[model samples]
Target: MDFKEKFSTIKKHLLTGTSHMIPFIVAGGILFSLAVMLNPEGAATPETGWLGDLASIGSAGLTLFVPVLGGYIAYSIADKPGLAPGMIGAYLASQVGAGFLGGIVAGFIAGYVVKALKKIKLPISLKSLGSIFLYPLFGTLITGGIIVWVIGTPISAIMEGLTGWLNSLSDAGKVPLASILGAMTAFDMGGPINKVATLFAQTQVDTLPYLMGGSRSSYLYTTNWNGNCNIVSSKKI
Candidate 1:
């Protein structure tokens, strides 16, 4: 296809692709967030209560099975042609903790890569080469490599580093930190403040798991107390 034609096709794909995935993204994110809220190690852990079960279910939807969402999105953009490999690509991305971002990236990569692969001109009969070894071979290698080496590793590092820093703060610092997070969350109605607190909590989860017996509960309690303080600050306003 000519440049104009390719641009038009790509534009059409982008619109269709984004439209297909947006709902899943929103739903999955909401479900994941709700799961986190319900699972808070507060009055009851997610292991027992009704809310805990509900949270588990929601979290399960986005867990290792997230490829289904990416697959469907690709199917919407590239039709039936994109479904199989799109799922494959998404599964690989999720393995490295890319979560939703990985899923979306995989969907776009699989759809467009397959679309472009189909358009490649060759002297040999594409019918034989195309199905036999083209799409799966090239698509999987490219998408998998990009995610494993380029995208996934660096993002995972940042996530790890952020969590590490939060865990390193002294005990006295936690409540203040949590308070700041709570204030931020409540102030923005759960946008920025929620992010800060959630980041700290996630960090705690990673690091506090190593604490023996009593230290675990104590550390968790302080963080929650601080978070409540921040929320109270917002309420006071």
Candidate 2:
């Protein structure tokens, strides 16, 4: 593929992953938020009774979404053979604190790895075994090793640095951050760009309430109000 075609294919893969990943994010995010909201102690993370259970279940779903994203992206790229390696790599990525970004990397790696493996000149007798066994085995080995040993630590450090920086931001710094998130939220309502921003903010929701509370949702409220006012102004008798 040429540059444009390759870019488009990659974009399609991302969108495919994002599309499949959305349900988990939405469901998990809502339940997690509700659990926190209903927590009597007002703890940022609840840890007792049904609320705790709810939170845990929601958190589990949140955690699984990354793997799902990775698996589906690979599935988009190289079909079913890529799913296992992608998910395994992504799960390792999560364990190593590499997060969704790492999951994306893992997906692409697994997909391409599986695709390349498919090109090998295997005997007809071994073709079936290769599909189920060899592809996932080597793909997972390669993808998981790279994630856990090489990229994992750097990705974790980058994420930690970003979180720390956000936390350290004063009101002035927060303004730009909020505006950027707000603009992303309003850009296409809930399209891919908005979801990308939402995914990032959602990941931080447990620790950064202001990102979701003030920056994203409230901005949408204001936009809707302004839009309503414009509609009123534009109406003529």
Judge candidate 1 against the unseen true structure and give its global Cα lDDT, from 0 to 1.
Answer: 0.55
Tens-digit per-residue lDDT, 22-139, candidate 1: 4543454456556556665753336666766765655554453447655765665556657766777777777886654566677778777777777777557666766546765676
Candidate 2 total steric clashes: 0
Please report the candidate that would top lDDT against the real structure.
2
Span of ten consecutive residues with least summed lDDT in model 1: 212-221
- Candidate 1: regions farther than 4 A off: 1-45, 49-52, 64-69, 120-134, 157-237
TM-score of every model versus the real structure: 0.46, 0.82
lDDT of 2 by residue, 142-196 (tens): 9888999899889888878877777776346767777677667666665667766
Per-residue error (Å), model 2, residue 195: 5.4
The clash count of every prediction, one per candidate, is: 3, 0
